[model samples]
Target: MGDILVDRQEMKKKVEKFKANGPSEPLDNIELKNPFPVMLKEDMMKMADAHKQQHHNFVQKLKSRSNERLEIPLKQNSKIDSNFDELANMSLDSDDFKKVSGCYHINIDAKLHEELCSKFYLKKSPPMSVTKYLERVNRLLCPSTASLLTAAYFLFNTVFNLKPSNMTCVVPLEAPPEDEGEIQMSPVNSRNIFRLILGCLRLSLKLIEDKNYKQRYYCKVVGMQNMPEMLRLELAEMFMLDSHLFINQYVLTRFIFQFKVFDHNVRLLFASMK
Candidate 1:
């Protein structure tokens, strides 16, 4: 029993020494199998060749189309000279100018000439009253509150540098009367005027805000406090209608100009009263 125990201790020591030293022989029998499949070199070359052939064909097609496009203009140019004689014989009359007063006048009849002149040369009717215009604009715009039209007008004028001459006080008729001698009234419609004013206001606001435009001059116009009480109330109402208008400094600046114009008119009215 003592000799058997001594043999077991010797065997344990040998196992410990083998573990400490690691394996002495090479692991030739442990074959390593790759988890991923390897692509053959010839197959890779074949794929590259196919891709190149497709690319070459695409390039050839592009060149052929480009050549055809270039040749089209050249083919069309040859036919242009042949049509010149036909074009020369055609008379080009001015749609706007009915009569050309030259050495020989156009052979149009006197009645026809008079009709053309009346149709083209008649002046448009004058714009409606301010109150009526505002009422119409409010109806069309459907503003959150009243007096937005008044605010829009002053803001538009200041921002866009509007002039009396440029202002379309009257709206043009959509269709002319069938009778040549009938009088046409071109009273300004609220819809047309409001659309124009709104468009200009939106465009100007966008430009001023986006480009960081200097608005100190316009700001002064809006900041005036000497406006009439009625006008001030209207402006306050406009602000209440859309708080978002105050978000942009440019829009806010324009908004203030409403008071300036009203203040000027009020001053004039008081002076006239005196």
Candidate 2:
């Protein structure tokens, strides 16, 4: 009995020793399968670039849609057009954040030309006139009605005081030369009215749009050789206009009426609305 007990103890001890040692191969030396695929640095960069492109495309789509909504506001909603109080009291976003098709397309016409000359101080007639340059601008930016109207407002305000009832826009003084070394700027005669109007339009586009176009591009469009001078004019306009740019639907509607735009309803709205 004693010998059998001692043999059993020795057998248990051997089993314990074997369990502690594990297998003959070390765990570090054993090869293990990977569950995930390994990606190289180049592959990772390409994936990142693809994501960036997708994001850029999404942003561009948003801007395009926004501009489309804002352009060509020549039409009216019969349901809303009659109610002056409602239109006036309506929220800022009532017309989709001031992007009214009412803010919609602006076309150059005889009526616009008459207003520019009689109201604003444009002396020259078409072909080489401010109106002709505006026609070119229409091709370039496709400015919304709101943008064009707001720009007109800006330019009109520049050379006229609001207090006067029958005031016409005055001709601006000659702008300083692009080269600071030059003694003085050239005369801003009747011929240079186009430049003033173009600057105003550029500023208006900047305010109404997605703020994507650069001043450098505006300089290119105006055939202004000096970028610095262009920027100076932008600032100068801002200063003259008292830095007020954002326009409301009410004011915009009034502007349309002031310009005698659209049909009898516009004339009616002008006559009726406060």
Candidate 3:
């Protein structure tokens, strides 16, 4: 019992001594050894350079591939003649005519305009429905009557280096209300209208050429199956409008000149029309 008391007293003394000393060093002052080896600054710089070089090489390879893919081959006379022959032989049936005349109820299914905008890299949002876009296009193209004024504007800009300002005046017309029967007028600019026309054209092309079954069906239902034919008809109509209005002397001339720069197939089609 005496020995136990002595040992307890000794333990107490040691505990009191430890209490007096507190910690050997402050927690923040204590040094810790890392398990992993520390990398040298030189080594880190070398690694960074290697990574940058790798990225540059990867970018170069992608650019090369892109260039190769976008390269167009020079066409021979035989191919051009064949394309012209095909265009000459082409004929629209009764059903095709009906489709072109807007007799068919064409519905835009599955938010196709969004998909097309994404594909074309167009940042603009599409109208609520494809029909609405079509209506806007028809209004712009025809105006009071079937006319080629818009076509002439684009052609003149592209071919004759004429600015859009020279072609059309920017009239502040009220936009159609989102809901039917709303007579609110929002001031729309001509440049925006031009962008809308371009967007509609690109959207129509995307719909007609989309590989997906549903999108293709929607395009077919809307009489957009023959995009080339539709464009040709519009151009022809524009020529008729030009004859009547005599708006610009170089309208058709610019179109013909610009048409010559197109691919042989497209050139052949237009040539056959002549």
Ranking the candidates on lDDT from highest down gives 2, 3, 1
lDDT of 3 by residue, 96-200 (tens): 332222211111222342332223222454444545755754553332211333343333322222221111111111222243232311222332333334433
Cα TM-score per model? 0.21, 0.41, 0.19
Please report the candidate that would top lDDT against the real structure. 2
Across 115-204, the per-residue lDDT of candidate 1 in tens digits comes to: 322321113332654466446544543432213433464343322222121111111112122332332222224333332333333333
Clashing pairs in 3: none
Q: lDDT for model 3, on a 0 to 1 scale?
A: 0.36
> What does the lDDT come to for candidate 2?
0.51
Candidate 3 segments exceeding 4 Å error: 1-39, 72-274
Best by TM-score: 2
Instruction: Put down candidate 2 lDDT per residue, 1-274, tens digits, no spaces.
Output: 3422446566566556656867578855744333112344468889988976775565455335434654433223322232322333456545532322232111123333333333322346335555566676787667777788888776654544221111111111122224322221123455556756866887888888775766677666666677877776677566544455656554444444444433576678889977
- Taking every candidate in turn, the Cα RMSD to the unseen true structure, in Å, is 33.1, 23.9, 26.4
User: What 10-residue stretch in candidate 1 is worst by lDDT?
Assistant: 166-175
Evaluate residue 25 in candidate 1 and report its C-alpha lDDT on the 0 to 100 scale. Answer: 71
Instruction: Choose 1 or 3, whichever is better by TM-score.
Output: 1
